[model samples]
Target chain A: MAVYTEVTDEALAEFLTHYNIGSMVAFRGIAEGVENSNYALKTTQGDFILTLYEKRVDPADLPWFLGLMEHLAAHGLSCPLPVRARDGKNLNPLAGKIAAITTFLPGVWPRRVLVEHCEPLGAALAKLHLTGAGFAPTRANALAPDAWAELLAKSAPRADSVQPGLGGELAQMLHGIVANWPRNLPTGHIHADLFPDNVFFLDGEISGLIDFYFACTDIYAYDIAICLNAWCFEKDFSFNVTKSRALLRGYMAHRALSEAETAALPVLAQGAAMRFLLTRLYDWLNTPPGAMVTPKDPLDYYRRLRFHNAAQGPAAYGL
Target chain B: MAVYTEVTDEALAEFLTHYNIGSMVAFRGIAEGVENSNYALKTTQGDFILTLYEKRVDPADLPWFLGLMEHLAAHGLSCPLPVRARDGKNLNPLAGKIAAITTFLPGVWPRRVLVEHCEPLGAALAKLHLTGAGFAPTRANALAPDAWAELLAKSAPRADSVQPGLGGELAQMLHGIVANWPRNLPTGHIHADLFPDNVFFLDGEISGLIDFYFACTDIYAYDIAICLNAWCFEKDFSFNVTKSRALLRGYMAHRALSEAETAALPVLAQGAAMRFLLTRLYDWLNTPPGAMVTPKDPLDYYRRLRFHNAAQGPAAYGL
Candidate 1:
């Protein structure tokens, strides 16, 4: 639900002159990405998405994101490929912001996570990791384990206000996650934020992946941990072992996990939980009252963090 | 910029069971009308718009609104026609609200109104009035003259807080508008809110009309008055007489205005300006600070009211 900048008719007509896509038939602002403004565009040629990167996205990182999409798409993955303008450049300026057009992928993001969705999600993610090996560009995860302490510092003082004793509990969890963080396993570009909304499906099969703004170079198994935390949890914050088994089975079918990687799932999952909990807690405590975006309840992630912290080993994750 | 209700994948799949339109290929929540939850849907058959009527729209009027759209499109007006389901009904339940699907209308709404857009807008609006004569069901404009006092009463207390002397000025203007409200003018169905966003254009020609939730039976000339205020005003709030003249000329090429209606243009325009001003002022004063939807500036309409109030006759409107 973001359209921070309005493109005037004159500006749009002029902007389209730089692209070879046919004349604009219909265009509309769409509620696609939160950090950037997205528009669903239709033309005499085909359907596409026009994205105007807002201030939250660094212009320096945009080319990497677009290039990753192109690389994944070129290797037979179904994803949005950036449409180059007549000048052979993917990034251009529109309405005082960097803008790009991507070929529209056909599917709807599953609003509710289903057991049937997890296996395909696992396979798609593993496929992404496997295909990303040849891409030369490397971007460190901005929200990596090293960065969690800085986020915790900003929110720890007030975290207790969200839940009784949350501040001290978060401090303990952060220290544990940082000390035990996995160092040496598979590494590649991982979609760090592959939540249900970022994965699209058609006919109960994975059709495409989107929102690569959060994709970065990290341990491949850490990507699995993120998906486990995102997809294998029930609404009650309880882990579903059946879904976990299905997800891991799907991932293993594509690329077998190393013994070290398999053994490190618990700590990686906890770290993943900590990353989201800290951010959500920060947003919950920091978002001004009556703000447009109501922050997610931090307590949900807090409960998941406690579960992951208590787990004995990979067996607890049904690996 | 709204998606007030989140439709689950299961609900959408079940809901589509009632429609013969091909299997869903893509669906995305779009920022179209502010009053309803709209999703742009692409299916194997073609593109369409799914609208979930929010609480602002009365459920009883849903059929009438759809009927009006059906009537208009049946007579070749190039508007979205309601897509009936296999059960031969247009309105159905989805996500706990009445929802309907309409054939998608292609073309972009002009972000910046231009003089070239004015003539076609006027001609299309006149055609709508002429074609609307056979619609059997009649809906009175809910925001008619009688409703202003109640709205003003709710907002008047904080009115002066928005401006130095707006409260008293609003009261006086309401009195004059209501006292001299036109009695008899060629009345028919009018798209009460025919602003730039409701009209779509492609290839420099009007393509479609939309948001029929605001359509109602009212003075046909009053619709003209509303358009004169909407399409003929420059961004700085100055009246553009050249655009006004072009609009009136295009309108007259379709249907001639009665002498009484012609003479009443100034007062009608003033009253039209008052209607929008009072509503916008009410929203401005009543909406809580930092709410999701930022209220439009009431002063813009206040300035338009002043211009229309000071006009001498239809000549001032470029007759």
Candidate 2:
């Protein structure tokens, strides 16, 4: 829940003058995305989302994110299309931050991961990967295996503060992931953070996907590995193989997984778990005093990493 | 900016089953109201606001508040009307809190008050009071003159912590206000808090009024006095008499002010300032450390109180 920047009325009115969407009828700061200030905006034309990129987002990558959405939408993918101003620019300045408007997609994110949701989610993920293959631009996954050692070094010092000897466990896990991580699998654009909250479902079908800020070029199977950790885990840290099987089956229906991709799933899943654990540990350690956003429990990923550490290849994930 | 209650998908789905508003398409917790968890809900039927009352509001008053909205909207006021469920109940339970849905009104609150906004605001206030006259239920203004002394006593001990010697000045002001507050003026239901943020405008017209949690029975002129301090004050802490004159003229056009009401405007305005100053000071002193919502600066009201203290009766307010 965040609205870090306050957009003034004068600045908003001035910003709207650049659009052909007619005068603003309503605008509200919505408690949605964590990295940006989002307003659920309604104009005489229609409803849209006005997002002011916050400091956490690198300004240089905004064109890539916006352009990726436009590219995906043009190819008939269900995603928010960046609305261009009358000046023909999708990105503009407002409230001392780069701002953009996008068409509002109507769907609620699933809070409870139903077994039926996995098929559509898996299908959408494969479609996103296939559709994004031809996009001209590329960005490296910042949280990939190579970056885990740096993350652990920063977070390992205080890991025991959250749980006794947790730092040593994380270091061992990071070392194993970095040494054995797959490098030969198929690579393409992946939603690196495809958490349940990022996917929207309507009428029990995947209606749209959002939060492309985490999109980056990475191993395609690694994206599937992220979903295995994100969608197949229960609150008690237990794996649900039924959900995993459904998700993998859904993806394979759209694009067949190569033999190398299937074989590398275990290490890839472990690396994926390590990626989240390190980041969550870093956030847990560095969250400022009185910060509004509560950091996710790094231990949840620690438990998942433990499972991946004990896994007997891709069969453990029901792949 | 608050969403105090977390509404789970299972609970929300169950809640929506009671309404014929169609299946839930989208639901997002909006950062609009401070007192409750407000979700911008979109169903197959249409858009609406779903509010879950937090602990700040009394549960017993839900009927009065919801009924008042129904009554006012029925009387042609452009405000959000409560949407009853299929069982014909507007108030229901959700997430262990009293929750209700209301029609979504389209308009943005003025972050920067303009002189032109004063006329429409004044006319709307008067119309609210007039239409609210026949509503049978009555709620006493909890922050009226009688409550000022208690509020000051609670805040005075640390008043100097905010501003040196502020406590003594507040005590003296409270004494003057309690002794001089008008009792014979015309009385009716009043929107005790008509700050700029609560009034929505579109195309320079007052499109809607909202946040009626503070509405209660009080002297009619006292409500005008609150508006005088709210709408007529510029950011620099200077009073804009032209705007004040237009506001008063607009109100008088709707319902003429009695001579006694006119004579008491200065004292009433001072009391209104004192009322807000004391509450703000209490909130400032008592806000828990690291609270998400920042308390307003009590000094702004202190300055307005000082202005009213030296004013030359109604003419000073552009009456």
Candidate 3:
């Protein structure tokens, strides 16, 4: 639901002159992507997505994101391929923001996570990790264990306003995560924010994955940890062992997990939960009074953090 | 930018069981209509628009609206035709809201209203009036003259808060409009809200007309009067007589304006301006705090009302 910048007809027509995608037939601002403005564009050539990167996205890091998508797509991963203009550059300037066009992938993101969805998602996640090994660029995870202390500090003061004693619980959790965070095990490009909305399913299979803004170089098993939190949790904040087993089985079928990786899954899962909780808490306390997007409930992640705190080992995750 | 109701994947799949439009391939919530939840839906058959009518729209009038689009599209107007399901129903229930699918209309809405755009808009508008004559169902314009008094009364208290002496000025204007509003001037179905966004263009020609939620039975000349205010105003709020003349000329090429309708243009235009001003003023004053949608500036229409106030006759409109 973001269209922060309005692209005038004159500006768009001039911009399209550099593209060989034929004349524009239809263009619409789509309610996709929180950090950038996205438009579903149709032309005489075909359908595409025109994204205007808002200030939230760093222009310097755009090439890495675009390059990652291009690389993965070229290696047979299902993702949006950046459509280069006649100038052979995928990135350009439009409406005072960096803009690019990408081929439209066909699929609807599953609104309700199903047992059937977890297997395809797991396989896709493993394949993404495998294919991304050859990509040259390296971007450090911004919300890694090292950043949690700073985030928790920023969010601590007013977090109790959301719920009494919430800030104190988060501080305690952050202490534990920083102490036991995994190190030096299977590093590569991981979709750090592979939430259900980012994975598209078609004909009962994962057709495409999108929104790589949170993607960076991290332990491959940490990606699995993120998914265990995102996809294996029910609405009641209860962990579904069946879904977790399906997801893990699918991942293992593609690439076997090392013993060290398996041993660290609990801590990695706790760290992943901490990362989201801290950010959500920060956003809950600091979102502008009238911002369009509602801050996600931090308490959801807090409940998951509590679950991780009580878990014994990888057996708790049904791994 | 509305997706008020979230349609689950299961609900959508079950809903699609009734349609012959093939298996769902893609669905993205479109940031288009303000009063409804719209999604750009792709299927194995073709592309279409899925509209979920929000509570704001009267459910009883759904037939009239959908029927009118079907009627106009069947008669060769390039509007979206409602896609009927296997049960021969165009409207159904989805996510506890009334939903319908329509063939996607192709073309982009002009962001900058140009003189070249006005002529085609005028011709298309006239054609719409002509073609709408044979439609069976009739809907009275809900925002007509009778509704103005209530709207102004609702907005009058906070009017001066927006601008000094604005309340007094609006009261005076309302008096004049009520006294001189025309009666019985070639009544027919009219697109009462044919602003620039509702008209789409491609290849220097008008391709389609859309958003029939505001369509109703009203004076045909009043629709022209609405267009004159909508398409003939420059950004600086000055009347563009050249564009007005082009629009009127293109309109007359299709259907001649009778003397009575011509004589009533000034008051009709003033009423049109007042209609928008009062509604915008109401919204400006009544918008809830932290509402997602921003209230449009009422002063824009206040300026247009002032322009209509000084006009002596139809000649002032460059007719």
Candidate 4:
């Protein structure tokens, strides 16, 4: 069970009246998280996951979550489709909080991920970006392109004390980045959390995706950059060229990158590095206690940023 | 100012009643971190950091945090010495939380960490372990060779699904590791978080050390493994042999390795890799949505583990 804010299930079932998910069958706390409360349910007819929207999930994002599922399902992607309520409303009030149920897709996250996994994940991302071609666009790109400055600013005060000139250099690099960010790449819905855990696997295949909460329309290439950061890096935190090549080739196979997308990748990679580094760095400076959360080392991404910063051109990363 | 908690200056002031510190002057929230709430504070005579225990910091472990700081400070280490409270107690009760303050060292964490940092940190670790010769001793040795099973078990469930019989193999590996874990070779104290951020630099020279939260007694060689994992791995997650060499050679200079220590490098590296893999994997499976924390890819350490798994002997790592 996660850190659900004192809400009880008996109180939560009140909202199920709005939804037509058959009789409340089996609901048990999912032990896979520390934030929201999730109950993997099994009704007379099917299996679904009931998610009790926790404090971190904004109420406004409910529709987006529902709508994205509908859109992705309508577009023929394998994902957890949100179940509509009896009132034909997607979201329902439960346990004095917002809650909803989504059909669960069966799959396992890969453990011994190899260069091979990179190819499919990249290609799947290409297809996923294309699948969200006409969904309701989102405005909540929390880790978007322009947030580097704000994040660096937050970390600036302690930068000299923590790591001299780190704040200044990060700010300067970001300024240079904004002035030259990529434009006009294939845009569609993106699964920002393309980490291995979110991508479900069934018998050596990517069965379906989870965690659409972070999905949105953005530069498709950035999705590739995220995967590269996510999948292509080696254990020592250096780039695995062979792995990177496999991933890029896989992405290109599914959706051919335009000359612009191709041209923008190195900088895109750098931008991607900056994005992860800034967020990780911000987290490093401002971690909340008792959250049971450990901030990822920003230095990991900092070194990657430095690597990409030194790249002379896109060809360096085989973009 | 962290998540759902706050640390009052009055409480910190109250806690500062004992100890040699002059007076608590200024304290403010650290804007970075996803685990603990840290405040940069200025005492009447010097700078210090006040950390209010947050999630992931169990209340029962407060003594270890305070005692390690006290112990390290007593041994002439330049780190934060926990301030005792007005009740003549070190741990203070504030905001329904346990908190402590330590002297802040002046220096930047190395930006371009070089070979030079390795030996100092290694020697420093050796010195700490030596000074920790004998105190009121009995604490969980996180780096102790015996803890590998618990480490592997945490990540075992998911790993079993991903790689069949993987958990058993890891368990067996642990059995062999414990049967052969290096022991009694100049064991004293160890700083588990020997990453670049915890190491300070002035003029690119090792100026001082801080962040002793993960300090414990264990195999002295395990300290080297921790550094190898921290320093040798690049952001892209690739292993850099040069950096690994620098780190290992640096450590070896302070505490020369016994033939057993030398022979233990490869297996210890594997155990180190597994330790990080388990923690990161635990994080991967258990991270909460809406948690500002971004889980580090367990795959990064998985790759490191895989690297070590393939090595035939300890000489492979040049210990």
Best by DockQ: 3
The number of the candidate with the highest lDDT is 1
Q: Ignoring the other chain, what TM-score does chain B have in each prediction?
A: 0.98, 0.97, 0.97, 0.83
lDDT of every model, 2 decimals: 0.90, 0.88, 0.89, 0.68
lDDT of 4 by residue, A98-195 (tens): 77788877654554457767778777777787777768667457778766687788888886655778888888888887888987776777787677
- Indicate the worst ten consecutive residues by lDDT in candidate 1 chain A: A286-295
Clashing pairs in 3: none
Query: Taking the tens digit of each residue's C-alpha lDDT, what string does model 3 give over A1-319?
Result: 6777778777888899999999898898887667889999898999999999987788988999999999999999988899998979999999899999999998888888989998888899999999999898999998898888888889888888989988888788788888887877989999999999899988898889998888999899999999999999999999998999899999999999999999898889898888888888888888785576667888898889889888889999887
Q: For model 3, how does the per-residue alpha-carbon lDDT over B222-295 read when each residue is reduced to its tens digit?
A: 99999999999998999999999999988999999999998899899999999988888887787775565667
Compared with the true structure, what per-residue lDDT tens digits does model 2 show for residues B1-319? 8787878777898999988788788898898777788999988888888999998889888888888999999999988899999999999999899999999888889888888888888899899989999898898888888988888899878899999999998898889888988887889888888998789888778889888887888899999999999999998999999999989988988988989999999999999999888888988898774565667889999999989999988999887
Question: DockQ for all models, in order?
Answer: 0.60, 0.53, 0.63, 0.01
Interface root-mean-square deviation, candidate 3: 1.8
Model 3: CA > 4 A from native: B156-160, B164-168, B289-291
Using all chains and alpha carbons, the TM-scores for the candidates as numbered come to 0.95, 0.92, 0.95, 0.49
Worst 10 residues of 2 chain B by lDDT: B287-296
Candidate 4 chain A, run of 10 with poorest lDDT: A1-10
Local error of candidate 3 at residue A41 (angstroms): 1.4
Decreasing lDDT order of the candidates: 1, 3, 2, 4
Error of 1 at B149 (Å): 1.2
Tens-digit lDDT track for model 4 on B1-319?
1333554434455556655677654343443334666666555575566677776776776787678667767878766777665566777766677767666564445534556666576666666666566546545665455666776777787776645776787677677756766666556567777777677654445656666666666777777778788777666766677777666676666667788776777778787877777777677777675464557777787677777777777656654
Q: Over the full model, what C-alpha lDDT does candidate 2 score relative to the true structure?
A: 0.88
Query: Among the candidates, what TM-score does chain A have in each?
Result: 0.97, 0.98, 0.97, 0.89
**What is the C-alpha lDDT profile of model 2 across A1-319, one tens digit per residue?**
7788888777898999998888898988887667789999998888899999988789999999998899999998999999999989999999999999999998888778988889888899999999999898999887887888888899777889999998887788778778887777899998898888888887788878998998899999999999999999998989999999999999999999998999888889899888888888898888774565667788899899889888988889786
